[model samples]
Target: MPTVPPTPSPEVITYTVRAGDALAKIAAQFGTTVEEIVEANEIEDANRIEVGQVLVIPQGAEIPILCPILWPLTMAPTRC
Candidate 1:
């Protein structure tokens, strides 16, 4: 019997925060919301994103893994 391939999942985008970059702007650029970005990134302060900070931008309902260099430690895995 012929086997079927698995469906492709939504892509996870990683963005590096730039100077004067805000959650709102980033969300708009990525076609997402600030709240979603905050939750996906586990950001303590949505307004406190640092320059060069890497962020995970989930395309759909699935959340991807966080950036490894977030804190120089092993970051815990989270579900979608």
Candidate 2:
């Protein structure tokens, strides 16, 4: 049986930079890593964010919730 993969969530949030804000600090506050934020916003310098700069905070990749009733018996169980 062929199994269909789950689609990624499109949810994202925006954050405004405040005084003394850093990539690391902002990442920590949002429960995400600095690298993820940088990749999402295409930031050239992780240390160069300015006050009032709007940042796209990519929430952690969500684990797809599987419903057994929706899946076929021949399909393997999802790791999630």
Candidate 3:
């Protein structure tokens, strides 16, 4: 049988926690699932996240961050 490769999923966005904000509210505001937020942040306890804690918001689709180092992928490879 021929082997099949798995598809890569989109990356999550990171958000710095703010005072008086809860995970539930953040998840709702981002239109994503809470479980996703928990998993992305690697929270041992979902309720334990605190202010200044960084959380990753798994976006439905990924938008790449612009940087000069990433330019090579768009150009043709030079002969070695």
lDDT of 1 at 5: 97
Q: How accurate is candidate 2 locally (lDDT)?
A: 0.82
Judged by whole-model lDDT over C-alpha atoms, candidate 3 comes out at 0.74
Q: Find the candidate with the highest TM-score and give its number.
A: 1
Residue 46 in candidate 1, Cα distance off native in Å:
0.6
- Write out the backbone clash pairs for model 3: none
Per-residue lDDT of model 1, residues 1-80, tens digit only: 99999999767788899999999988877778999999999999988999999999866643434444545455686443
Residue-level error in angstroms, candidate 3, position 74: 44
Better of 2 and 3 by TM-score: 2
* Native-to-model Cα distance after best TM-score fit, residue 61 in candidate 3, in Å: 6.6
For 1-80, candidate 2 gives per-residue lDDT tens digits of 99999998777788899998999988877778899999999999998999999999886634334445645555666553
Name every residue pair that clashes in candidate 2. Answer: none
TM-score of 2: 0.61
1-80: candidate 3 lDDT, tens digit per residue = 99989989766567788988888888877777779888877778878778998877886824334445543465665432
- Please count the clashing residue pairs in each candidate, in the order shown: 0, 0, 0
